[model samples]
Target: MLDATIASLSELGYSRTSTTEIVRRAGVSRGAQVHHYPTKAELVAAAITHLFHEQANDVANRLETMSDEELDTLDGIDLLWGALGGPTYRAALALAAASITDEELKPVVTKLLREFDETLVTNFGKYFNFNGEFESFWPIGLRFAFSTLSSAALYRELGLEDRAEEIVTVLKAMTSMTIKQMGKNSRQFGIQS
Candidate 1:
């Protein structure tokens, strides 16, 4: 049933997905689905939760082989930007798009955004060991990365694809400059090129 929900959500937006569609796609009786999910809301929520877990797992897998290392804000930007530009990010965005019309699913999008922003800031401050302190740059760096990545996603939607690398490069440079200025504002941490 959960698998069915993810499939349907991936195919259709959250709002367009119904219990019937999921059960139909899953080849399960409505009774079986109801027995587990009880409500469409619950089922979709589960699908998103699954998506989140899967994404985290993928990140862990990617990091698993790397040497123990900290990721700075720019590194976080690169890591996250690269990840989201991949298939997982694609599916997650599609799900959230469909869910936008659904009040209950709004939290899923909010959760993803909150996690993205907070993780970028926290990991950057602690790991990646970027020199500049978080005070001057965390907020701006986060917002800039978010906006740039969101635009990169939009670029794909607009059929102007193949520019993710270029876009990410420019964003990295911009983020780096922001951090450079941050050095003057803070002595907490700073990463030198």
Candidate 2:
């Protein structure tokens, strides 16, 4: 049912995805949908949460299969970007836009988005270790990367698809330079691993 809701949101956008649509897509009874999710906001929230878990698991599995040499900030950004470009992310983006004017959904979406941000930070911390005080920057840096990539996706939706690679390339270069500076400062401050 949640998967059906995500599909509906991705295809129809937030305003048009009624419970009826989700039920039809899931091939489930309306009663079943109502039993699980009493409201559209609740249903969308559950769907986004489900997608978050799936994304986290996918990233973890990919990290587990990577060689040690492959574990770095740029590769991590690539992995994250891949997830961000998916249907689930598209669904979430649609809901995010609707949440702006939706009083009831605003809180729900806000809470879920905050949780997602924390999850991203935790996942990055588990898979990669920046040096010393630079480690403190991961949460901020990850959020910055997420915001930038998400904006890039919106730009793609607006028909600027050709600039996607350019945006990602510049993001990678900026991140790499920042990491290098952080490492230099860490070494200078005797904060070596």
- Scored by lDDT, the top model is 2
Q: Estimate the TM-score of every prediction.
A: 0.73, 0.89
Residue clash pairs of candidate 1: 70-128, 71-128, 72-128, 130-190, 130-191, 131-189, 131-190, 131-191, 132-189, 132-190
Clashes of each: 10, 0
Instruction: Encode model 1's per-residue lDDT on 70-180: one tens digit a residue.
Output: 434455666666566544555577776766786777887678667755654554444444443555646666667777887887676557778866788888787767656
State the lDDT at 64 in candidate 2.
77
What's the lDDT for all of these models? Answer: 0.66, 0.79
Which residue segments of model 2 deviate by more than 4 Å? 183-193
Instruction: Point out the worst 10-residue segment of candidate 1 by lDDT.
Output: 183-192
Error of 2 at 143 (Å): 1.0
